[model samples]
Target: MGAAFITPGEIIENSSNLTPGKGTIEHEGKIIAMVQGNVIIDSKSNTVSVKNDDEMPTPKVGDYLIGVVDRLGEKAATIKIIQIEGDGRSILPEHQYADIYVAGIVDRFLPAPVDAMRRRDLVRVKVTETNPVLKVNTRDDENCGVLSALCPQCGEDLYAKPEGDKNVHCPQCDYSGYRVLSNGFGQGYNLEKNGAAAYNRLKQRWSKEFDEIFKAGIPARSVLLRADHRFDGRKITRPNFEGSGGNNQRKERPKGTKLFVGGLARSIDTEKLKEIFSKHGDVIDAIVMTDKETGNSRGFGFVTYSGKASAEVAIKELHKFDLNGRKITVNNADDKSSSKREKKPSGKKIFVGGLDWNVNEKQLEKLFSKYCKVIEVSIPLNRDTGKSRGFGFVTASEDSADKAIKALDGFELNGRKIGVRESENKSKQKNNKNQRSTRELQARREEGIED
Candidate 1:
């Protein structure tokens, strides 16, 4: 008779082969105890019971019970009995429902509780003192009631029809439910999430049985199934950056709130950028792009804000403004390079230096068009003198640029040695060969930061 006492949801046995009896319930392919009690394994019957000293509700002959209509089977309807009147025992959300046989149902001669008892409708019944498991009868009780319920489709409160067909119907929507409603059916009470009063009522007024299960800290996986769906503690999974903040904990902006700052001067550091941008809004974070190996500014970085409004304001005020001698462009992190990518910058742009001053765009295109697809050829000329500007640019495919670099570089063409190399956007690059010593400016520079 003596057994090991355990708390609610404690694993009584790892095996689900045995049947859960009395205060025990089967969950997640395992039989777990539902109360602080003894784990009773009956080998002969192949059954388990959570026996405990706590005064759990026991079925007594002719005792009135309060229960919710769980569901109806062909032979019987299951009732989630919550309270046993006069015995002072209540049904908990964690406590599983018990089966109510058809014979025990009121109006035994009738086929079923048609237009009478609906699923989720609360009811009152009398205990019949049944065998292996307890059974209750709702055949006769004027005090019994259908506490509260909602429309299956629209989530509006189901109003009871006391005069007509006597079924519950949604006043706002075309939905109905068969229920034996007492005086407390639809007088402005509901269990829908949107019902402010009802939600608070459910939260504040659950019975002691539900309170016990609530404080038990039931695992999340099985929490939704329980009667009380309240969680007052942190989840088992920890926050990622719990204690990473230094002496003073710094607030962090949300992931997408970061704005990418491109075309920045290499001399601008995180603090300097933060100081300038904080004037527009509250900057949560400011990180100047730096080389991983050498730890130097790579001509750009990111600034973050706690709110979307702050980031938008920062972008509008600070974009294209001079910062540490370089005009910085500030855009949202996602929109930063995404719009830039649409302008065709993946391939190389070839630069043609040391031109013969006589070569035109057509003549240059005629030369490199033999190597690869020449996108465009531009030979600048003076309007007053009408002569070549000494140097021109030949834009071609990346593979073609490589070919032109190897073939035409330092090669005599039209009696002049022409120099050909990858085109460089020398606008943003401050050439910090003197300022930064810690890290090399190689982050986006190699990928054409100027682009």
Candidate 2:
């Protein structure tokens, strides 16, 4: 028969029969205790009577039980067993009370051992026997018993030290400290291999119970089956390697000159540009000119290289590279004369290009007057025709020249892109000297003299 509870003063006439006692009988196994006298049996109630001959199992010493750590002392630690799984039955219900004892812990050694066990440290033990005196009542202090003590530092059993010994040391860690438990065995609890097993079991039991109570209505069984089927189905899907286009479809790096990649398929943007140019080295900056009103590309843009060498390389390699069906133009960044003059902090001559054929010195000054006070606008005249060339030169104070260059470099006139660059004064000077020398030579030759 399964273990049952009985109370004292109840006459257990036989294994299956019982007589009402003067008090309430609480029975664990065959052992009956008298809880209250004048017992009355109510058939409608759940309580039942047991016979005297029914065997009762007792909790002996060296019995391994599941327990939770409750308290940690300097020399010893305490644990309380919430559930006892065996022939022995608890005097009270598992939920009503817990059993605590010192012998079941690792503190059988010294008076405050270092690295002593503490509360919430789960342990497993072999119950050697029970303390008859303490087992009489279902009280906290009465549930004490002896068990095997395992040292926390070393896996060895703790032995009693000789008289007057002040310290206990573990040879493994060479940890020497006060003993935690001085009474039953030694300091430190030896955690058993089954310690974790008990913890897992308890966790599983409680988790199952919690799920049952909180999730009773949910279709958990169906969900679990569906999940298992999905896992099984995952093996059939193969990875697609051909989905990614071949290496040729991959982007190539920009090289040589800065390419003004215009007519960009509207789909291309800054990100696409970087992907195209990143191989060249490093793209210093990339700007796509856009129409402010429509927020679309202006069909032209520029990418700057870190060095002129890379720019030159980019120009040669990528000048006419096809990008999204458009033939891109790659060249040195157009040197605008006005921009060069502005770049110089000192007053200097500026070369301007991409001018309208009709635009002359007076027209240039009128256009630039809005930006700064133009000192002069000199459109170089063709020597043969004495007509204004499309390009011209501009001179201004250093500050005004910079402002004008910035203002006019990208400004549109007659629907044409203009180029501006700083003029090399030294080269111009050397050319003028060469011309004068040649003229003097000619005159000397005519005069029949050496130059």
Candidate 3:
């Protein structure tokens, strides 16, 4: 018989017999087709899979799975497998969960589960065992394992330590750890939303999801993760000639190697820009921004080098350096989050102290107004006399507050050399005063004994 037409929610296969496959979902002890397609049963695998008219990518046994390390357990890891290596798209029908046991991970003996993998490590594993539960093996794979891993202490991508037995070092911070490096290691981390979302899916294994795949039925290939794989680094400023090949290679551009070159002349071509940047380091690929249709320079381009260090050197040397009369800006293309985090703090609240008894809100506002926007001003007063207390406070923009303190403090305001600085909130102020008073009392006792 030809493949049978199937509709969503229609039970196509029984749980006791065939396993669920592509375009299928498991609910209430039955494998139901989730897509409108023809159901095809694989006799060898005894699994029912739905085949759409158009070729749809169905993950099969032995397929290479790529994802970030999620949770590490006693002997297994919760891997958030996002895509199969051969699958063109990194997307899935939904975020998938795959579990692997200690034995299924690698060939060599790992003393502890963590020795095999670390959190946030991007890994590649091949499905070795598949049944109701998917099993993967990262062990004994010379070419695959962890492609990108970070330093545990600093979260910076690691570099091949100056010299070691396969140890990786954090470039930003001095910390190193054991690693299971793939053919390509020390590539920068891709901290994008999708990548984060992939890991976050494992935060919970909801009852609805357990019934959907894990708890009562065959694990769907679309969201399968097999454990029992042995799991498992490093920066090297590798030279370019070895791998420098094509423009498309840049599309697979590694993290730190990519550079965003802005402020380009409309006349400048990709080759010219590449030549200009190549002096500082090896340029793997270069592309001048161009019109989608007309194919003309958009006055900005990207240049990628073989490694992060090389790209950094090029950026530092070329950033704002007059290039053919235009000072071009060069920076890491993937440093968007890092750039935002590095911005200086502004409008921070600061405390003001040591005000003269004569100081009033109006006077304080007038004094600090020259520095920054005066948001509010308060002067605590003596209730009986209704005059200014020994001290008061001034609240202003961070920049203005900083300026006010520097300019007016200790200026003999109203015959008193007033002090000014960041203010501790009232509770903290009381606590500090109490602590200081204790110290003063202890000092007085010691002085009396000496006398």
Candidate 3's residue-wise lDDT over 341-367, tens digit each? Answer: 334334545555667666766787777
| Deviating ranges (above 4 Å) for candidate 1 | 1-5, 8-34, 37-53, 85-95, 101-109, 176-178, 183-451
**TM-score of decoy 2:** 0.20
lDDT of all predictions, in order shown? 0.62, 0.47, 0.62
lDDT, model 1, position 132: 58
Candidate 1 local accuracy as lDDT? 0.62
Please, what are the lDDT tens digits per residue for candidate 2 over residues 1-451?
A: 2234445544433323443332234354332444422223444543433434543434455444545445444333445654454444543322222333433333222222112333333333344435432111111111222222333433444333422222344444342322222222322234243221121121112234333422332222223222322322232212222323222221444443454555455556777876787677568767566664466655567787867777667766776566664446665566545643223334656778888776766678888778776666666544334445678888767777777787788677667667766666777778786555557878989999964
* Candidate 1 structure quality by residue, lDDT tens digits, 308-395: 8988999889876755434567878866456453254346688888888777777888888877678877665553344667888777
**Cα miss at 319, model 1 (Å)?**
83
Ranking by lDDT: 3, 1, 2
In every candidate, how many clashes are there?
Answer: 6, 58, 21
Better of 1 and 2 by TM-score: 1
Q: Is candidate 1 or candidate 2 better by lDDT?
A: 1
